[model samples]
Target chain A: MTTTQLSPTPRTTVTRGRSRAVLDRDALLAVLAEGLVAHLGLATPGGHPLVLPSAYAVDPSGPDAGGTLYVHGSVAAGWVRGAADATVCVTVTLLDGLVAGRSAFHHSMNYRSAVVIGTARVVDEAAEKERALGLIVDHMIPGRSATLRAHTRKELAATAVIAVPLEEASLKIRGGGPVDEPDDVEAGVWGGHVPLRLVAGDPVPDADAVTSGGPVPPDVVARARAL
Target chain B: MTTTQLSPTPRTTVTRGRSRAVLDRDALLAVLAEGLVAHLGLATPGGHPLVLPSAYAVDPSGPDAGGTLYVHGSVAAGWVRGAADATVCVTVTLLDGLVAGRSAFHHSMNYRSAVVIGTARVVDEAAEKERALGLIVDHMIPGRSATLRAHTRKELAATAVIAVPLEEASLKIRGGGPVDEPDDVEAGVWGGHVPLRLVAGDPVPDADAVTSGGPVPPDVVARARAL
Candidate 1:
């Protein structure tokens, strides 16, 4: 309660304590890029919110100006239809640390997260939409567009792509130690951080990966190492 | 779109060209429990949708009753306060497979997900609130509760807990190989399955873990392997 008045940009409600509100775009973008799952928030026609886990990427408008978030669903997805018309909200979070406390009630987590609030303009045009697809492909495998077969017109029709512009976004992130309430700290609970991580084991190439194939690609290895 | 009309349940959406939308309670529970993160959908005080990424669990009740979901947030969380009196929509999703294709347009993910629409009730009573916190603690670390200190009365008062009964929930699941749009199969795109996993490394106990400070505990090592 005292935090709301003392801390600037204080969230109206302090759900998850002071730890939930992440600040700024640089921190947000880092969280988004490092994380794997994304939450696509859209309004139902009846007015309730629909939040689904989705695979996404931060789109580059190349070397200038702002970026857009790229997300996709089946053309038949109600979420896409929901996204096509309304101002959709998107979020990506990575749980980086699990804070262990002396008491059950005092336990918490430290995480890096990105939350974006924007209207999704459905990419309907052919050329611009290709860019969205490229962002998504490169998101999973860098330099994949040049290596893979291009999309045909029919395949394009079934995929629905929505581009959420990178404006009006904020990241409320908290990382580091457990801010245990004073009384709870000396309660003699095993207190400290259990550092959580996203790690990669040896790559299992496709069963049919070419014998002709070169060494495990540097990009894939780099991405896995980064995780 | 035609799937909505054909579904035997309430408000079932189209499963798309390939049957990706599955409607089952068992499936929903699996998806919600498999992943550690949940995109908790709540309405912001501003009346727009706010999707926060948090941790959650599907808590099944005794023999005659069904399960409910437990999601935690800051006592003063802006969006959570919105859920206290209104219908709350909570969704949890796990991305398990990457359906790669020769064509960029055909890339997809193997996913299992759950969405629950329910009214959240505040855990007002002290005894019940304690149980809720227990669920959250065990949700993160299965057998660690008995090993930790219990919360003090003051710590309990500072937390807010809410439960959303999982009665009117829907689950949509998709898994398996790439549904190559008829033409791209021969395009020689390296495609099949790239499985995603959450693995644990050797346990690293707190620096001051034991009052006497010995080697890492066997219990921690066993838990890491289980994860």
Candidate 2:
């Protein structure tokens, strides 16, 4: 039920805007779990950075639940290969709403974000890699891995899974309505929080499945309904 | 109107998984403009990369339209100071849906993202900095800057604005239903896309304004209605 707290290292510390930084481990993990994708920053051989989008998941409960972040992609991905030993940065952000203020300068957003800094190690063991891949799949669609066919040897070989420890991670959150200046607040100008959320629309079954004539699984239907 | 296309240089080229790469300049700009925040990747003094979230704006149409990305924050921000002449990677991603496949390995996401590789230049001129600040404010809520009180000279001095050119940017997109393997498709399992979108809810007026009883601005009401 608990993970280690965020470290006080210079890289992980929230120096600029201290009020937004969250040090609690569980809160940080919750932010990570809420996001579906992470922006991974890797340093190229030439010393330039590449920030790319990739699906990622965090262990919900286990020894690695709060400490390890699992990310997988095609074996041919250049960033994945570079991340094996190179220092990397991963960020997951969920935008909740737009904070509207009386003054444009005070406008902001209600969001939750987590940033992890570490060197990613490749999961070479087949068993561990397979489980990591499953965590990722289920991360997107809960209970999905159990319903799908197991990953074959060929499929497993074509995938690359990397693990980054959350030793130097930090969570930042901004919530609630706008904090406009006192003068602006009394100026009779409108100010409020415009809530924004990710809503899922009805699913459109694939064309190829029409001929197959198979019933949609209960879990898939349930997931869509919850969204 | 079109700006220059993505460069064919080795670093900027789409070397791996070429199918997801998009070379159209306008397409890349559109993706950048869709997202409210951008994850900026910058290297630390010790050469480690850190990816952090910050508000951003793209000039929609003008001399700098589709070519310049503007990002601003407090002058006290370390990353903003480090990014003055350092190579920076700016990424803006918009998640559209969850692409569910019959097999775990084939599951994917529907997203549009743009990655820009360039060194951020500090905007030091007072006039240009002020103008850039307005551009950013209006980017989130159109026509907002004109109605608000002018930013104080002290506030302007305490802010730093960075500009990165989009000349070496590329857009990567994946949409529609999952492209499961032929065998999986014939396995008679359900597969489809769970469409996702950022929906805006009704605005809740600030508590302080409740007593003032000021009318909500038309632009604020219109923006919420459109969302």
- What TM-score fits each model? 0.84, 0.94
- Candidate 1 residue A201 C-alpha distance from true site, Å: 4.9
Q: Which parts of model 2 have CA positions greater than 4 angstroms off?
A: A1-5, A60-66, B1-5, B60-66
Q: Which tens-of-lDDT digit does each residue in B1-227 have in candidate 2? A: 11223875666766565777666777877777668889999988878889988888876552353467888988898888789888998988888888889899989889887888887889888877878888887777677778788887887888898988766777778888887888888778889878887777887788886768376666667666766
**Cα-based lDDT for every prediction:** 0.63, 0.80
Clashes of 1: 15
Q: Residue B188 of model 1: what lDDT?
A: 42
Q: Which DockQ-derived CAPRI band holds candidate 1?
A: acceptable
Clashing pairs in 2: none
Error of 1 at A174 (Å): 3.0
- The docking category that best describes candidate 2 is medium
